[model samples]
Target: MFPPTPPIPEELTLVVDGLTYAGLAFGPVDAPPVLALHGWQDNANSFLQLARALPDVRLVALDLSGHGQSSHRSADATYQIWDDLPQLVGVLDALGWAQCAVLGHSRGAIIATLLAATQPERVHTLITLDSMLPRPAKDEDFAKTLRAFLKDRTALLNRSPRQFASEQAFVERRARMGEPPLVSTVLADRALKPCDDGFAHRNDPRHNGASAVRMNEGQCISVLQALAMPVLNIWATPRQGLEDDIARQRALIAENVPNVTSVDIPGHHHWHMEPEPAEQIAAAIRHFLV
Candidate 1:
C-alpha cells in the first residue's frame, strides 16, 4: 500500500544566464541524481508524490524556465523545445554533477530524450511518463504553423494572468480544461501564488504560443536512435492519434536503442499526481534503476 506523502524536499536554485531556476531536492545528498522535470505549466512539486515513493535514488525536480519561482525568459525569447538544452546542461555543470539518470514527464521527457541523445555521457537512463520525443514537424504545415504561432504570440505576449477569487475557484477552473481532470488542490501546491487581490497562477502567458519550427519524423527518430543509454517509457491509455504517434516512435526506439521497455498503465496524463498511480510508477522506476 502507498504510504503517507513525505515532507517537502529542500529548495535549491540553479542560475543560468543570470536567471534563477528553482528546484526541489530530495533523498540522500551524495547519491547520483535522478533529475525530475515537470511538464509544461506544472512546477517542481509535480514530482512530489513520485519523489516520495522513490527513496533509493536522489531526485531533483526542476520548474524549468517561466513556471514557478524560476525567472521568466527575456521578452524576445521563445520557449522552444531545443532552447532548453544548453541551459539544462548548465544546470548539470553548476551542480558539479557529471552524470545522472533523467526522469521527465511530457515536455520534460522530450528534453530528456534530447539530452540523452546529444549528451549521452551526462545521462545514464531515461524514464518518461506519458510522453516522448516531440512530434515531427511537417514541411507542408510550416507556413501555417508559423502564422498560427505568430498570431498566438501576439495575442498572449502582453496579456496578464487571471486572478482567482479563491483557491477552490482556481481548482475548479483548471478542471474545465479537459478529461481526467487533475486534482486541483494537488496542482495548486505549485500552480497558485498569493496576490494582493487573490491568487494568480505563476505561469507565463507566452507559454501558450506554439513553436514556429518543429522536427520531422525522421529527425525525431535520429535523435532517439542516438541514445546509448537504457530507456523506460510509461504510458496511460491511448487518447487516439497522438498516442498512436508515440507508439510508432517507440517502435523505432525498440529497433535501434539497445534496451527499451514500454509499459502501459491505467491513468490520465497527470497520473503521477495521484497517490495510487504515483506509487505504482515509483515502484517501477525503483526496480528499473536497480
Candidate 2:
C-alpha cells in the first residue's frame, strides 16, 4: 500500500539574532504542528523525505545556527544547551505556534529532549532518533577531548575555505568519506547548491567545531526526570554500547519519565534518512500524534 502523499511545502527564512535561518513549513497552517530538527552538519532539508511520507500534520524543519543558510557568529562561541533555547522559541513564536511536538536527530535530539524537559508546557510530545541522554566524560578523557578540539579549532580558524573545481569533484570526495548509501544521497542533495563557481556545500565548516560542547550524566538524568510530556526514544541497530551502561541508562529514563516508549529501528546511526527507516519513523510519529 502506498502512503498518502503530503502536500509539497514552500521554503522560507526566519531571522533571529540578525541571522536569517532557512526552513520549510508543510501541511495546513492550523494542523497540529511537528517541529523537525536535523543533526550536526545537517540542514532543514534533511527532513524532506520523511515529511513527505507523513500526513495531516504541519512539519517545520529549521537550519540550526551556523549551519545551512543560517548566519554564523564571528566569535568562537561554544554552542551550548542555552544557545538552542532562544532559536527554538523564536521559531515557534514566528510560526504563531503555541506548542509543538518535536522530532530530532542526533544533536538535534539532545536539544529537543532538553527543551521538553526544561519547558514541558511548550512541547506536546518528543521523539529522539539515534541519540541517548548526555553522558559525562571521565576527567582524563574530557581533558583529552578538549585539547584535541582546541587544536582542530585553531587549525580551522587559520585555514582558508577551499573551492571545488566542479560539483562532481566535491561529490566524488564526499563518496570517499564512507557515508551510508541512503544518507550520502540525501546529503548530496541538500548540501550542494549551484553557484557561479560550481557547486558548494551550504553549511559552514565551523559547525564541526561548534559540536564540542559537553554535559554530564547527572545533568542529563535531571532533565529526563523533569520531562512531563510523552517521549518516544528510537535507537538504531549497530548499537553503541557497553551493554551494562546502556541498560542502566534505559532503566533510569523509563523509571523517571512518566510516559516513555522505545523502539529500535533497523539501520545504522544515520537511519533517519534511509528509506525504510525514515518510513518507520514517520509511521511512529503519525501513531503518536493521532
Candidate 3:
C-alpha cells in the first residue's frame, strides 16, 4: 500500500492573468526545487504518492488551469502546449525559483521537453515518465481521435452535477469505468465538494476540452535536439507496441542530446498509481538525481 498523503506545508495560489492556480508545496523550501507535472485528466494530487516516496526533495505540484482546484479560463481561452510554458514560468517566478528540475508524466512530459528545449537555462534537469513524443496524425484517424477527445470534453462540460442516489452507486459506476483503480479511493475523496445542492465535481470540464497543438515528428526531433539539460526518460513495459517505439526514441535522444539516460519500468502506463511500481519509479528517480 502507498503511504498516507503527506501533510502539505500550506496551500497557495499563483494568479496569472487573473486566473488562479491552486497548488501545494512539500519538503524543504530551501532545497533545490522540483516541479511535478501530471498527465492529462490528472491533478497535482497525482504526485502525492511519489512525493511521499521522495521526502528529501522539495516538490511543488499544482492543478493545471482546468483541473483539480484551479479556476477555468474563459471559453475563448487559447489552450495549447506552448501556452503552458508561461504558466510554468510564472509559477517558478512566484516561488522565487530561478532554476529547478522537472518531473513530468505523459502530456506534462512533452511540455517539459519543450520547456527545457526552448529555455535551457531555466530548467536544470528533466525526467519524463511513461511519455512519448506525440504521435503524428495521418489522414482521418487524426481527426477521429481529436473529435473523440473533444466530444468527451463537451459531454463532461454539459453534465449536470450528479447526486448519487447512494454513495455505493457512484462507487460501482466508477469501478465499471476502470478509472485508475489504485487511486480511485483517493480521487473520490478529493473529487467532490459539499454544496447546498449536496456535492459537485470540483474539477472544471471546460478545461477538459481545451484546444491542443499537435506536434509532428519534425517538431519533436527539433525540441529534443535543442535540450541542453540532463534528461532521464522512463518508459513503462507492457505498453502496446511501445517497446519498439522506445528504442527509436532512445536513439533520437542519444544522438541529439549530450546528456540522456533511459529506463524501462515494468507495468502498464499508469504505474505511478500502483504501490509497488511507484516505489520503483521513486527509487529510480532518487538514484538518477543523485
In candidate 1, residue 1 scores what lDDT? 54
In the range 45-106, model 3's lDDT, one tens digit per residue, is 77777777888889898777766688776755545667678878888888898999998888
* Model 2 regions lying over 4 Å from their true place: 1-7, 139-146, 166-171, 195-197, 210-213, 240-249
> Residue 36 CA error for candidate 3 (Å)?
0.5
lDDT of each: 0.83, 0.74, 0.74
Q: Which stretches of candidate 1 lie over 4 Å from their true place?
A: 179-182, 238-243
TM-score for all models, in order of appearance: 0.94, 0.87, 0.84
> Candidate 3: where is the Cα deviation over 4 Å?
1-9, 138-174, 195-198, 207-212, 241-251
lDDT by residue (tens digit), candidate 2, 169-225:
665675687555456555655566677677767666655663364666666678888
lDDT of model 3, residue 15: 95
Counting clashing residue pairs in each candidate, in order, gives 1, 0, 0
Better of 1 and 2 by TM-score: 1
Q: Rank the candidates by TM-score, best first.
A: 1, 2, 3
Which digits, one per residue and each the tens of the lDDT, describe model 1 over residues 112-189?
888889999999899998877787778798888889889988898888987898888877877888624456676676
